[model samples]
Target: MAQGEPEAEILLNTIESQTLAVIDRLNRAILMLVTGQPTVSGYSAMVGTLRPSFDQIAQYAPRWGDLIPDAPHIRAELAYLLSQRGPLDRLQTPHLWAALGLDQESVRQIYQSRYGDLPSSERTRPTAAAAPKTEPPSLPWIDASLFQSLQNELQPIYLPSGKALFRQGDPGDSLYLISNGRVKVVVGEGETAKTVAEFGQNALVGEMSLLSGGNRSASVYAIRDSELFRLPKASFERLVEHHPRLMLEVAKVISTRLENATSGKPRADQALSLAVIPAGDGADLGAFCDQLVESLRTHFDCAHLSRAHLDSALGEGIVDAPLGTLRESRLISWLAVQSELYPCLVYSADPTLTEWTKRCIRQADRVLVVGEGRGTPDLNPIERALFEGDSFHPEIRKELVLLHQGGQAPQHTQRWLAHRQVADYHHLDPHNRAHFDRYARFLVGRPLGLVLSGGSVRGFAHIGVLRALREAGIPVDIIGGTSAGSLIGAQAAMGWDDVRMEQENKALFKNVRRLIDLTLPVTSFAAGKGFSSLLKQIFGDHLIEDLWIKYFCVSADLTAAQLRIHRTGLIRRYVRASSAIPAALPPVLDDGHLLVDGGLMNNLPVLPMVEIIKSGTVIAVDVSNPFYTADGAYNYGDPENGDSLPFGKVLRGRVLSRTLVTPSLVGILLRCLEIGTINMESVQIPKVDLYIRPPVDDIGSGDVSSMDKLIQLGYETAHQQLKGWKGRPPA
Candidate 1:
């Protein structure tokens, strides 16, 4: 017997005990079915609810397959019942029993044996449900030998009851697998501590931090005297080398806990990684590429490699080396030649690769197409190169947009880019090494606070911004939004893709135009419910709590004369309330006060984001296009009188009307120039690292077709903003 055999036996026994408890529940349910007056519908519902629990218990104890007779047939019966619709009485009971391979008499006898007796009157009827057929082996069974082998690789540590294994925010470098007793997972500290879950023997803990290589998100404390197998990162890595399945298991556990923690849907990162920056003809593409390489080298432990360098380094080792460091130099040279062996390799867009850029594009997870401000490079050759690749790279579907440098968008550039089905960026400065460095840090691994500024129909540009970020592989961990931005931010929090969002936005605007009952007059609040209904139809039953990322919507409370950041409520309602421009829609009522759009008072919404995300450096994306060169290009607001405003004359509804409505075009332009420019001085927040104000002017037409230009601008701006940001592979 192995050294850990006894402990493994104990673990198996505990799991068996839990399985038996589940069986007991099943037996009791059967007893009620035999004697109790349960309608066929009610009985079917009971079975439906209980079936999953049986499967869950079975997963924990695979041996249940042997112990539980007729389990397979029972599972089949349950499945069949679940698949059927409408009245249950329409089916033949005997045919169901035969198909389920169940004997009613046997079930009643077993139920009667366990619960003393069944009602005499009920026994005369068809004997309820029977025991399930023997289940087939399903769960991945960890035998004594496997357990002992794993134990030999890890150090066993014992802790007294009430002792902590690890605390929230503590640096973690080890995985803890419980050998005995239990542990409680807690979040927060001191009086604010809250228990999230408790796990017993054989359960894994601390894997989240171990996999992420970050501080613990929560704390684990021993609920009782416990024994744990502590596997150091080194040992776990070795184990994964030999048993790859173990890694998948660990990922599953971590994913489950994360889903529960954030109330987000289960999601995995995309495999295809490529960012294409079109450095125009005038732009120095090589210098820009070198800067990106340097920033990545400074931040991540990575080095650049070209085909020539790789061949030369492999064939002829470095000749110039210090006496003592000859071996170190040779090793680095060898590794450079063998870059494919490393877990991560970030390369530059070598001009040489341009000859095979199309083939390279197929192989790469991400590709950055650098072009001039005028338009994209001749894509015909690149597209032709893609056809030469034997096998398509999994991430080939990743972004392939044109990144422009300097100047306003060229007239022909839009047509050219749209023809290639690619987006364009004109806001990035290739010379800004400092911004690239920060962007590199963001790309490698940095939490971001995404602040979305309200811009009504103009907000469609934000989709391009999100697409660029997604392509670059930068994830926004926290979000704040105002008015139309709140709608975009909510979608981000829900993990909606950029393409889907763009399509939905186009559909929404079309619906808005058609649904507005102009016959009823604009001042009568006729469009409010229809608009709200549209939002509901699109968002469905999603709540603010359903947001995968921490998020808040900004709105102004008219009665309180205050800006409010709402964190929890119906997501559609929150968006509607935040977008309630005085005369445009009805004011949303909350806590006896009416609230309208936050843009009038807080158009930028930086403070609300700063308030929620206190610790990390905040990177904000300010989308509000408050500046316009010409009066015709400017978007203006109307008068906000109670009679004219659809939100009503309650509390301080007219507060913004009195304070914010500036009639002078010169004054509005000046204020826009003052507030619209994004800089540290303007924001006044010490923690803010980067605040981006994309080049977008107001569009008064609100034309749906005009959105393509805004989206293109957004794409170009976001792509430029993420100049040094790069995507990372799944951990």
Candidate 2:
């Protein structure tokens, strides 16, 4: 050991002790001042009263040079106080404000407002640049005693002076904290070797690589016979689970080293790579690639590359890249460079999975597998590699994404892919491309879409159900709606997050009477000003054409007798038309045409959504049920023998008009919406069809019992359906 080692150790130990004492005093003093919540009138008086504690902090502050490595402003503030004379009041100097991390112009304004004198500042020096920001949930530095106790939990090892701890380029499997003696960090071979840094007691080594999941950047050797607490990767991860603050401290240490290594400017690459693959037969690879490329290009505004590959047998027709039997390593290297440049690189898999295709899958950070509805693909060699052989990389499943051709996945497929993500497929439409924009932000393996069906007040129950799904982290990427569903769907599509939607739902239901015209019978005209007012309150008076989600609002043109799916327009227009109950409220006039409720034609707009989405799964939350029969089928209201039919079914066509005359005008008008349609039977796409049957005979009542029942059903259904998927440990 060096002659000065004991003195150096004693000095460090004293500094650590004093530093902890200062921190304790500072925290108490700050809390004491903040508790009273002093106003500006007594602010200066409070500062004067806390002068003694402040002096103590200033007295011990110099010893914290190493303890507070990142806070230059704090150090500068302390230095100015150490040189001060009288009480700290009426001294509005620019340097003093700068030392407290305030800008010169802001300080100048404060000085002009208070002290009334702008003092000549000839001796002021520039303040140091603020510390680089760290990702949040920051923690205070641990005291030496607490740090030592943490080390006691790990196994200790001793090494001779000449022993090497680790070599550059080796896998970083552990980190070492010096208990005694010192270690030297070195880089390069013997001829070019240079010392990078040195560490002594309590200093950590090899933490950077361990935290980053990278190789060691330098070699470490004990300069003297040393005792070290060896924290293996497993032990470190276990500690992280309990003490997440340890990650921040480790980041601080690494940031210091990195700042020095790069002369205070380290450029870290923040980009990620993704690969898309097909998981079933007859899947459209070209459409999937185009969707992925367009989504990435539009969202990130960066180049999105897709390499269209073909088997050697079909090489004659291949246009993108003709693989002329080159070396596999060289090809991989070229692809790796392309990946570094582009945020997303989609590789179109050949009909036959080859060794080269598997290599591409292996290189990706994430892989999305596209498949049609209800079908699971046979395990190819690449997929088989995920489970078999000595390399049992279970993480391969985490990378796997099952994007359904339609919105729904079969029960068997869902069970088989319990660990993987299931996402919804989306089409490229100019008006609905906002769905891709919102989806690209998450960059998730499993993307989701929401489908809402109309059923007047019953749709409120659907909203509660959607809230539960969102709380469970089941992503909802886009929304498609019909009638009352359009009202709820527009709120979601217009960027109303869970908290906002829940609040609005409660507020709207509380004043349900204001939205219902009591003077009129229960007909289409019964919708009052309160519904329009609530819509305006929820989504302001603006056309949300550039919203983050792609939405479909279905409304039928009575004049044209054509079903219209409006994507881009004033949201109010769609909501008004979709909510236009025939014979009850006036038909909504849009683009000089009269449009009625879309539910009259297609109550469950799932088939329309399924037709457009080229890839991915969909979540169809149906609130509409043309009343269910005893046999669990739709009750298509018949008017035979003076039976009063549901209002919507009556408007289907002239074929039913001959027998659809009302038996009791007022009674039928009030109970018209009670009859259910055959919309569910018409649905051909496989999806999550949630049929919400309110416990009451009347579906449109906004009573508490009905709303509560719907909310409970939604909560129970969400928790049950997402049982196998939610809150599992990461793969």
Pick by TM-score: which candidate is best? 2
Residue-by-residue lDDT tens digits, candidate 2, 354-385: 54445445444445555543456465454455
Report the alpha-carbon TM-score of model 1 versus the true structure.
0.35
Model 1, 1-731: lDDT tens digits are 32323433333333334443333333222222122211123222222123333323322233232322243333333323322421111122333234223345554444344433433433345344332321211224433333334534666577766678988998888877654445788999989998766665445677655677899989988755555667787777786787676676666656665664453211221111233333333235446556666766653334444444444753333222333342323333243222212213444344433522332343233445555545544554444343234333321323232333542322344433443432212223455554455444434434367777777666777788889878876666667888768888888777678998988777777645654543354543345877788789877767675444557887778899887788867788888888876655668888888888777567667666655443234565665645544545422343443233333432244565543332343334323333522443444433355556667765532446778788888889878866854333221
Each prediction's RMSD over C-alphas, in Å, is 26.4, 25.1
* TM-score for each candidate, following the candidate numbering: 0.35, 0.37
The C-alpha stretches of model 1 lying farther than 4 A from their native spots are: 1-446, 515-527, 627-681, 684-686, 725-731
* Alpha-carbon local distance difference test for all models: 0.52, 0.51
